[model samples]
Target: MSNVTLHISKNFKELLQFLKSISFSRAIRVGIAVTLPVLMGIQLGYFEIGLALSFGAFWSSPSDVSGSFRHKIKGILISATLVMIVSFIKGYLHFQLWLLLPVLGLLTFTIAYISIYGFRASLISFSGLMALVLSFANESEELEIYQYAVLIGVGGLWYLLLSKAWHRINPKAETEEFLSETFLLTSELIETRGKLVNPHEDHEKLQSKLLKLQSDLTTNHETLREILILSRRTSGWSNYQNKRLLIFVQLIEMLETAISNPVNYHRMDVLFNDHPQYIKRFQDLIFEMSYQLRMISEAGNDHRKLPKNDFMRQCFENVRRDVALLRETKYYEEYLMLQNLLEYQEKQFEKLKSIKRLLGDPNSTEINVIDRKKAKRFIAPQDYDPKLLLRNFSFRSTIFRHSVRLAVTVMIGYALGSIFAFQNPYSILLIVIVIMRPSYGLTRSRAKDRMIGTLIGGAIAFGVVFMIQDPYVYGIMGVISLVIALSLVQKNYKASATFITLSVVFIYAILSPDVLSLIKFRILDTLVGAGLSYAAMLWLWPAWEFVEMKESIEKSVKANKDFLHKIIEYYLLKGHIPTSYNIARKQAFLETSNLSSAFQRMTQEPKSKQREMNKVYELVVLNHNFLASLASLSTYIQHYDTTEASERFKTATEKIAFNLERVVQCLKDKTCNGAGASSEDTTLFDDQLPVFNYLEINTLKSNDTETLRELQEAHLVWEQLEWLFSISGRMLKLSASVKLD
Candidate 1:
């Protein structure tokens, strides 16, 4: 009994966390926009009109995602216009199946096709499609079709105004929330890396966590970048913007520095082979730093003072003392490795100090004024070229395939409803539109979730209806469920489905006497919709993950190559890093994240479709590790004083670049002469593992500090380059092994 109770408690806590993770404020705003109309209509004895307004608000709310004010407004306005158009057209054509069937197909295809524009546009397009779906079920006989359409448009405008007012009330809310979440993620990343100090830790699990965190952090960084940079552009710069931007800059650099911090566990184990206590101390110190960042994140979120503690400095001093003690021994290699790690710790410490000074001290004048014109380069431009739409008309284009699949599925669903005469034919239409996706995995998952949630929700509603028959109670629960349903749709779709079911059933119970019948039909229609949707994905132009694996891998490798080129350039021209270098870095990170995400989705697919699964996983791991090794190389180059690039360094980097290029070509052409051939054919670097000769180590120990630093820098560069080259070669071999092309 105790164990069961504990399990329940744990799950309850997790449920609360999941709910808190979603933006309750946004959900409340949506609920308010939707609920106010119903309340007004009830007061005026016009429930049908209120319900239509609610539909418009619900459909338009999906476009209200976090973004710049201008883009947010633009998305909402476009969604409003599209919803009006879709609703108006659907209203006029509903009475004639012959006209409606063909028109619905065209409209569905066009709406799904517009998703090619981008994420925001895809969401706006979804709003329009949703409006079309809801329009089929409209029974507002009092208003003309045009009036109903106009009322929906007005509801969208009402929601838009409410959103604007909220923004005015708390202008920095989204920015602060995103920035704080980034900080928290970064802190988790730090703690995850810190775990590697322990020699017995599970490396695979840590690596997986690292990949997932990197993927999420990449999204947060890009979103926050858009919000801050684009807002500054529209509103002009201010002290408020300056402070936020400065914090963001520091946060970004901190993440890069953390990424670059080399976690060479093998070397650490060898060096501290006998001194495991040092590892424990180091891990504790890292956790302390992580905790400090967590505090800063919370403070930033709550508008409180950032921490200004000396705990990290004290921790660093202890580690330095350990290093000093080791310096008296004959362990020169161990001393050098520890010294290098200490230097990295110092850099991290300095970054923390900078952020603290800026945030905790208002009079600190360390604001780096960004060039407005140059800043635009950081925000990736969205091309709305009409040619893009036409170009994607081919069968090869996934969007085109998805568009056709959705149109057919919708028409089939409508026909099935007409033939069988389901109590609510529109219910089947709702399921088809809501569940279908561009990928097989997503559609299958949503179908499963919809089925399970509907069954569970039906059971719950059946019990609730028998136990309580009060309309007022049903009304309150319905509103609560609606808010929760909208809130969880993005975070946890299964829970969203359950709540949506509850919302629908409770609302209907208030209007109809036969609640059990409604529940039965709800479950039946959902099962039919779910089954039909998944069947469509399985049979109709199934976009198998393997088909796109080659392209994704190629892009990721190419991005890494470009990033490596930029890092080498920065080393050669060691001044301030150029914007192009940062851009290359961002692309590399983004592409790597994209590849990881694709691989994840592929895993969720049917086993028969998972061609070359093992090799593809290897390729993903190789690309991810290659980026990490490259980041390590960049970190050392950017932070330490180093000698000019040697011919040996350039030769090794060139070979690595060539290997990456070969991998790309192999992926592109589906052929490779041999994976081992070119890598083994290199002259300057050998196939044997990199090692420092005893004589070289002795020589370096005797040299002056500056000469030793330069030689050590060169050695680290050579080692990283060779490792990266090996990874690239492995990628080429794996790409060749896969028959993706």
Candidate 2:
């Protein structure tokens, strides 16, 4: 009983926390924009006009996500324009069913196809689709169809103005919130990583969590880059901007350090198997660091004074003490690896302290001005090239197939609804649009979530109608439900769906007398539409993740190779980090995350479709490890001074690059010749390079930190390159086994 109660309480607390998140805040803003017009229209005897305005506002709100103010304005305007245009066409064609069907198909194909541009464009396209669906709503004959379209356009502009006003009132709110969330997720990632130190923990489950967090962190970092870096480019830097930007950089660097810390959990376990206390100490310090980061995030969110991190300092002291104790153990060779991990933790600790200091003192001069040209390189520009659209208009294009599938499904849904003479035939089309996705797994998941949500929402609305008949109460609940629904749409689809049903039912209760009938119709329409969506996805040109896995894997391997090349270049140059290096690193992280995500989706697919599951899993694991090893290598070089690049190091990198190229070719050509490293390749350069023998190094009794640092750098670089070569060879073997060609 106590355990159950505790679990419930924990979930309740999490719910409360989510409600306080930035997503919820955005939802409230959108809800206000959507509902205010209707309420005003009711009071002024222009309820119909208000409803039209509200529709416009609601459609445009989807594109009002975080970014530069300029981007936000541009997205909102594009969405508004698309919504108005779509609404006008829908209105004029509604009375002509023969014409409306073909027009709807073409419009759906065109609008959905435009999503290939990118995320913001996808949201804008979604807005247009929503407008087309809602334009099916019966309108008062008092206003002409064109007049209603104009009012809807006015509503979108009204939302734009409100959104702008909100920004002016609190310009940094979104950026600050995003940064804090990033810190929090990073903290969670650290905590999960700490669990890997335990011998009994489920390593695979923990790895999955880490990958999921990485995917989410990638998204947050991209948005932050767009917000902070681009703003710096266009608006110039302020003291506040400088502080935030510095903290952002620290956050990213800290993530890299953390990711690289766990190069091989199996190795760590083996090294510390006898000295469990050392593992405990390291784990405790990591947990403490994660705790301090959470405190920093909380402080930033609440505008409170940044907390003192004396505990972190104490934790590091404990870890250092343990490291000293490890020196006396028989694991002398393993001590270096442990020491490197300790250094990584120390680097993370320093970064956290720096972030706290930067946040606490806005005037701090710790931030150096980044070059404008270099900074601009970090922001990835969206390609709106019309040529891309033309290129993708084929059966081979996933987006094209998806667009066609959706159009056919929607047209069929409309025809069925019309034949059955449903009270609200458009609801069927609406559900199809809301639930269908480009991928089979997502569409199936959405269909399931929608059905469950509609049922629960219907029950709740039914109970509410039975107990209360006050229109004012209905109005209040409607807005609250709308806000909650939109907020959770991206985070929790089932919860969002339930609230969506509630909001719709409540809004209808205000205008219609038969609340029960409306609930029944909503439920019926949802079931039919969701079923159709699931069927459409399963049978209509399905793009299975397994079928696409080879492409994803190839992209990831190629990205890692580029990243490795950049690191090698930096090692040879020992100069400023190039923009291309950063770009390559970003691509590596993104592609790896994409591959991980695709693998996850593939697992959710039908068992028969999951070809070579074991091989695919191994490949995913190897690919992730390769990136982690590369990160470890790069992190060490970036932080410490090293000797000039030698011929031996160049030779080793070439071998690794060759292995990676073979893997890529194997995926493309389904053949691998001479995949494994030859004995000559492994030892060809060993005779040419100086060996930093552990025993000899200690015999010198040298206290020169520079000499010690150089030795460590050489040893780590050589070992990392060897590890990369081994992993790439394994990847080549696995790629050959998968038989992608």
**Best candidate (score: TM-score):** 2
Candidate 2 residue pairs in clash (backbone atoms < 3 Å): none
> Among these predicted structures, which one has the highest lDDT?
2
Q: Name the regions of candidate 1 deviating beyond 4 angstroms.
A: 1-22, 45-49, 95-99, 232-237, 261-275, 301-308, 362-366, 687-704
lDDT of 2 by residue, 246-265 (tens): 88889988878878843466
Clash number by candidate, in order: 0, 0
Model 2 collision count: 0
Give RMSD to native, each candidate.
3.1, 2.6
lDDT on C-alpha atoms for all candidate structures: 0.81, 0.83
Residue 51 of model 2 has an lDDT of 85
Q: By how many angstroms RMSD does model 1 differ from the true structure?
A: 3.1
